[model samples]
Target: MALDIIAALVYGIITIIGGIIGYINASSNISLVSASICGLLLIFAAFARLQGQTWGLTLAAIVTAVLLVVFAFRLAKTRKFMPAGLMTILGMLTLAVMIHQFMALRR
Candidate 1:
């Protein structure tokens, strides 16, 4: 459970860093702004989970699943071991850990 919480925080921080980089590279793009907002939400969700909020984990699960699909598509199209591939792999591992923790809670 502690590991899951830490992973969730790492996930959120990585996403925010990516968004900041993207925004710096493309200042005029609306998408970067949207991405940054989503990243901020992820950070909030992580904090919420840290405070024992059940909805936080649920929200993180949904966000990570979406990110996994996006990264998977990018990896498939490029067919290389790039950032997309790396993130996709991490997202899968994190998602698995999250699911296992949730299952334990149910029992």
Candidate 2:
């Protein structure tokens, strides 16, 4: 549980930072808006996890799953491991942490 909360918080922070960078580098409002939404969702998910809400974990898991798929696809298509690969790795770790916490809760 502790690990899950910590990982979620870290992931949220990283996501927010990435969003800000994306916003700065984005060529259009659409990308900026999308990044903003993603960052906000991640922030809320982190707070929810900290509050011990099941929904928070669920939200984080869902978001991470989506990110994992996207990043994995990008990595495969580009054959690069810098950002996409790295983010995918982190997403996977976060997912694992969430699963561990959920299983412990079930027991």
The sequence of per-residue lDDT tens digits that candidate 2 reaches over residues 1-107 is: 47877787777677666656656776556545654666567668878877878788788788778878987998999988856788889999999998998898899
- Residue runs of model 1 more than 4 Å from their true location after superposition: 24-31
Question: Candidate 2: misplaced stretches above 4 Å?
Answer: 25-31
For residues 1-107, what per-residue lDDT tens digits would candidate 1 score against the true structure? 47677777788778767666756776736546655665666667778888899788888888888888987997999887655788799889889978987897799
lDDT of 2 at 89: 95
TM-score for each of the candidates: 0.83, 0.83
Going through the candidates in order, what is the number of backbone clashes in each? Answer: 0, 0
lDDT of 2: 0.77
In the order shown, what is each candidate's alpha-carbon RMSD?
2.1, 2.0
